[model samples]
Target: MRKVIFYILISWWLVACNSSVISPEMVDECPPIYPDYVGVTIPATIAPMNFSCLDGEYERVDVTVTGGKSGEVHVNDKIVLFPQDEWQSLLKENQGDSLMFTVCIKKEGKWKQYRPFPMYVSSYPIDYGVVYRKIAPGFEVYSKMGIYERDLSTFEERPLLENTMVPGMCLNCHAFNKTNPDHMSIHIRGQHGATLMQIEGECELLDTKADSILSACVYPYWHPSGKYIAYSVNNTRQSFHAVKDERVEVLDLASDVVVYHPETHELLLSPLLQKKEVFETFPVFSSDGRKLYFCSAEAKPIPEAYKEIRYNLCSIDFNPEHGTFGDRVDTLIHAAAMKKSISFPRPSYDGKYIMYTLSDYGNFSIWHKEADLWLLNLQDGTKRPIEEVNSEDTESFHNWSSNSRWFVFSSRRGDGLYTRLYLACIDEDGRVSKPFLLPQENPWEYYDRSIYSYNVPEFTNMPVELERRKVERGIVSDKRIQVKVRQ
Candidate 1:
């Protein structure tokens, strides 16, 4: 009957996709995307023009300059000065002379001049991701701290989230992060103690009073609903039983405004193991925001270390209404059939399919061997290899487009240590097309030094805040809010 027809239809679609071939012309057709290059310049000193330089040159001399993202160096767009003239007004007042400026050509937005730093350099801006490190020795700029916006065409850095927040050393692991909608979070470590911050203009301290329940919060994930924010808190300061345990907590963003609102709380599940006893971490929400999926290792100290260092994907159904989660569980994948370790599970926007990377840690270099892409069906839980999309080369860090019809991921399959971003189309039948590399006109790509580790890719629809504002304004027509949280 109808059930048989559906099965037959699904089978035909799967066969057609497996036998399909992607062409090179498709790569040329992709629209160009440029990296937001932030150019800066700093003098050895910042005193008045007379004494600002070690040479003690010029009297009240006017050091004129201009800059900005568009390359237009107008009065307040992007410029810096030593004597504090009209350009100074455009800068974040009180900004030191070491301030960076941008002078955009009225025509192409090509930077006219970018003062070189005394000690360090910049990372290339590729589609997947970009990591910048400050080279100055006593320089306070954290390696992981930098202004990030969905579209930098009109971005302005806020002190709370950008400047006065992240500690220099902690930036790498607690790098700048953006959650669902307009919600942003950062792990701000200061002289008093470390606090898990969640805010847009400023870093709101989640554990300001130095609470003992958690030591430090990092690696935050925003629930799709934007009402909840979750992060892993360190418990190294506390005494442990035979079983070492860390806690993951969620905050009520709407009501958790105080230093630590009473409404805020942690999940009772403390690194629970599956029937086989494995440790789990790095949880992500499904498209429907019902299930929490993450990677798990064996339960032994380092416990559950995939003898091969391979991690399995697992999930826990969470019912937000009931405010509780079900038991720890594994997906239906034949765990033993995987070749290399499976890492970084990313569910598509439609919730119909999931994509992940497959590779061996020994061949950690993205250039050493290929990290193939695999797809799984959420309906019946059927899994298969994406043959045309993978190579003996490295391919990881996949992200979905706003429509779910397109996806962007990173791969060094044929390109050496050079991992670039690719855009692929997914059909209605759940078939993934060949990946097309991002075609920015420039040949200068952001090259990552960590051979084994490539940049992690994340995608979003529009600005995070705008989306949240729409929900608050009731402009969205979807009645999905009525959908119950899965338990």
Candidate 2:
């Protein structure tokens, strides 16, 4: 009798579950979802992009994702949470194909099925992972900050370094040489400040603050050869605004650009870059390392004249063999004439195009609401804004992948406060596709509740292998290698 009762209970429970799944009314409108994954192109190696229904009237939601060739996934919830194994199997079998989603919602004792949508799966693969800084988008006072790397294939993040290791220190401007993990440069600001450089897996601390320079290194870019690094030293100050739309204004009192040779512990100073009348910053090297590009603007009175400051895109010939600069500087884009400022001039690895952030007037574009990404065709010198990839909110700090076919940028599109990472693809003809937000297991839950902002999103071909304890010890120690100015 006991065995028969147990079997009857099991049968009743199964019936309850199956009976709850009702037949849909077959609505014509499509279902509302967050992160807008519909009609977007996704990489096969990326994690499942979980999303939830935007319509609050629904009590329960069911999703059926069917691949073109082999696999299918059935999920039941208010949020579309996919199983990892099933998602992977579906993507693996349907590469260069499409996935169709059939969404059904339960509301007020009734079920409604919406029209299905499709998402294209790209045949091309993305990088291994990306490294970025997680910080609150605040001014002056930063509570906690760290640099972290995230694996694209999964939602695993590890810290390269954190302020908890050494209190009162802030890290920024983390860069790599052509996505090579063995070579990187990071700057730490505060009392124990130094430029930590990793060369061929060896880490060293360098005091970049030379007496001859006005200030320490602010922005950095590594040459393709990994022998030299270009940095900008700026005496910067910030002022608060009284207006409601704008909050803060950052101005450079004085600035100059210099190149540093790590092997010789020497700073390569050029008279053209160090001109007293001009403010130079955001230095970058061409793909072949034969040309150096930087932003320059005429010096103006601080705070009072900040609105008039605009940077023009300029390039100068670089002789990597002897670490010398050319005599003449060519103005690639006359941003000043157009009443605009340019920052973060990054050239693609293929040398076909250059990507930069254009704003109304200052170099610090993250704070500028009008900032957007613009691309320059190096072959034809034709420049235009990437409308497909830009948004109304601030779009700043972008980097290209190793193949130059994909790019990642920081945008505050979701909340207009915290920045998030977005990725887009560029074809051979320089046409940019629609950008999608970075995938999370539950994008709606994660982005809505998270307080941290993603900063300086850079793509890395491999994981950054650095021992945390060793790096912390080096940062806290007093031992510092002073860099010499090459006279």
Candidate 3:
């Protein structure tokens, strides 16, 4: 069989430092270049490491790979994921002696589970090596998962549970948080049995009045110091008729109390909170945890009037030292062009600018529908159109990377209806470059089908050394990964 062996640089070298195996440092060598953009070509008989089913039913087989490069690998049929049999493939070396190849599996006559798995071409000149890992069944269900390592070789699964929030509840705003290395938080609905669980080792309830206050909390921002979490809750009734036109409330983490719309608010008032008040939500706290930015709107009565969900971004002074949220809440940006809704306000790491989404709540279509990205300058409160980035279609649910150099947000620029992850580079002058879709072609393979979702992507700023150590020995100081509960 024709085999393609690839090489990995020493970049991924961490923990064990096995000179014989590829390390994490080699990861940078593999970029996600598409075939149309840049093709990869490998040279020589350098054999990349191999993987097969533990059953050992399929014997070791050799295949050669040619014309394959780091991000782009050419694999016709060697890469396969058959649960019943053993699978093996070869890696080839680039002219520079690097490793690169694509892997895939065939199931039910369809060529699926294909990914560009970057390999390390053994400069050691070894003919072959063994790759080992047990297959996780297709039945296991997951709530919210993020890509820690994106390239095929190092890309592994990591959970947001260390801080306790479900994927379904969070993907709307916070995809993942790089700021919090260990414990992560997610927004959940307390209305229909959905509760926010704190993920320390496992998901547990975060004991606070928030448990009883808002009907649902969508996006959560962790404080820079990791002491508190700021989130917004929808204070609407569970009735389908009531939710379509409910209001939002912002909550303070330190005291587990409702700061913006206190318990006295209309949503919390009557036999079912008989009295009524205005609605507010989408609370995003600055990195320093001093200012809390949110959106507020007057609640409407008609469901068809859902398009009336017009909320303008606003903020209040927050004092982390005394756990006191001061008054003086003011509106940052409110455009009548939104026709109604302005939500999901995300602040940059430096606290210089804010990005938010504008959409009509009535019709959620991306085509003729309109949703765009807007920026709010905190300096002089200047606002303008970011034409290079926003379009009439839809651009919402955005968050910044730790370095604040790149930001990830979901958009419907491609297939109108299907929302995909897009990464845009933030220039030094605060101008955002054109956005590109996430490299992973099938990142949304496992998600709810009916709704036009797939949002709240959180990026991690984990150190290179930390990821290297993880891939080498599969060991982490975090208790969640180390221990397993038996079924």
Candidate 4:
């Protein structure tokens, strides 16, 4: 009803504008476009995959999209800008179908039609949007950065919190419990260093460092029940690479994993996870909350042996009922045996697959050019690289949608400096499709001169309910509840 009326308004507006349709000379080659939406499978609820011509001197673009169900949408402009309501209607009508795009452009007073392309629509739907950090690529300086959320259905992005809001503070390490915006945990560093969390609609500021803990919490993941959050306390250090195009090698001196319960303000410590001879980080809970997955490496001398640091995928039984851990640990994927490192191990909500980033040696994969996404089949214990989505550049920091049908990853594939977000679909039978870039009203306008890099992308079922006043109040109050170490 509302969509139909809005779509009608769009059609009437397009007709009223009286834009002249061009008859283009047919060309055999497809038009090279930015973001490359051609032949990629995307969720029906995604934003319009608008793109701009990359090669020619074009002043206007005209695209006609025809669905297999006979739904058609045409628009003419300098770039492809599909009507929001009409795009939604078209997608809803063409789920599990293909859309043929006939693109034409006017260049030098003549119109040319390129070879048509097909964009497949996946039957599965994505989350409401994604939440991620946008930060400048300054390795040594305190640059402006913020955590923002975007609506997948439209071109809208809003900041959950920014460093500017709390002056001189660095914001990072944010996590939500299984896409639930209500259960969120974000960290702030500076004079009022603390972790701001909202669990079950109750907000609290916590100073997670206890007397026994080595350092502050980093790389957090929420338990399924929303009662516990696993965090890695690390003594982190970094050094610059002398070679060109090399990034700051962020290395861990010492790290340990601990689980914190909000109700009792207790940090559960396990000697198996925090052994002095071992480095553990990036802990996440299984979908059923019965197991804890993390990355572990044998501790070596810092800086000199950093290249020898290889983390393997491991897990331990977790008793959510008693807030306890098992006596033994199991090595799931021995990445070190193959001279590879695993970082950011994320389990699917459906419990069928675990996606992780694999690099050569070090755990900091974002800077490792060989970093690629791999899928671990938990049911059969088979793991393989997601070949269809992997490129010649870095692909790290990935998360699955709540439905486990789609995944979002940050890649340094474009220009090899700034990380851009790309989404790919995986059907129930585990067929991964070619990844597509995050859409924008004018992608070229933004990506052409953007200086910020996308980081830590994760899907969310709803827009985060972070009240600016509440976060600001937490920053100003400088009060945090101290968590105690569990005996």
> Which has the greatest TM-score?
2
Model 4 Cα lDDT, one tens digit per residue, 171-241: 89989999998899998888878999897678999888888988888899999999899999999888998
Tens-place lDDT digits, model 1, residues 330-375: 5645343454556556677678887876665311223325467788
Task: Give candidate 3's TM-score.
Answer: 0.53
- The order by descending TM-score is 2, 4, 3, 1
Q: What's the TM for model 2?
A: 0.96
* Backbone collisions counted per model: 21, 0, 61, 0
lDDT of each: 0.40, 0.89, 0.42, 0.91
Global CA lDDT computed for model 2: 0.89
Cand. 4 Cα-lDDT: 0.91
Q: lDDT order of candidates, best first?
A: 4, 2, 3, 1
Would you estimate the TM-scores of all the predictions? 0.51, 0.96, 0.53, 0.95
Runs with alpha carbons beyond 4 Å of true place in candidate 1: 1-147, 150-167, 172-180, 188-203, 207-215, 232-277, 300-307, 334-339, 361-368, 444-454, 464-487
Residue 76 alpha-carbon offset, candidate 2, angstroms: 1.8
Q: Report the C-alpha displacement of residue 223, candidate 2, in angstroms.
A: 1.0
Q: After superposition, how far is residue 207 of candidate 3 from its true place, in Å?
A: 5.6
* Prediction RMSDs, each to the true structure: 22.1, 1.8, 14.9, 5.0
Pairs with backbone N, CA or C atoms under 3 Å apart (clashes), candidate 2: none
- Candidate 3: list runs displaced more than 4 Å: 1-178, 187-203, 207-212, 236-276, 336-340, 360-368, 441-453, 463-487
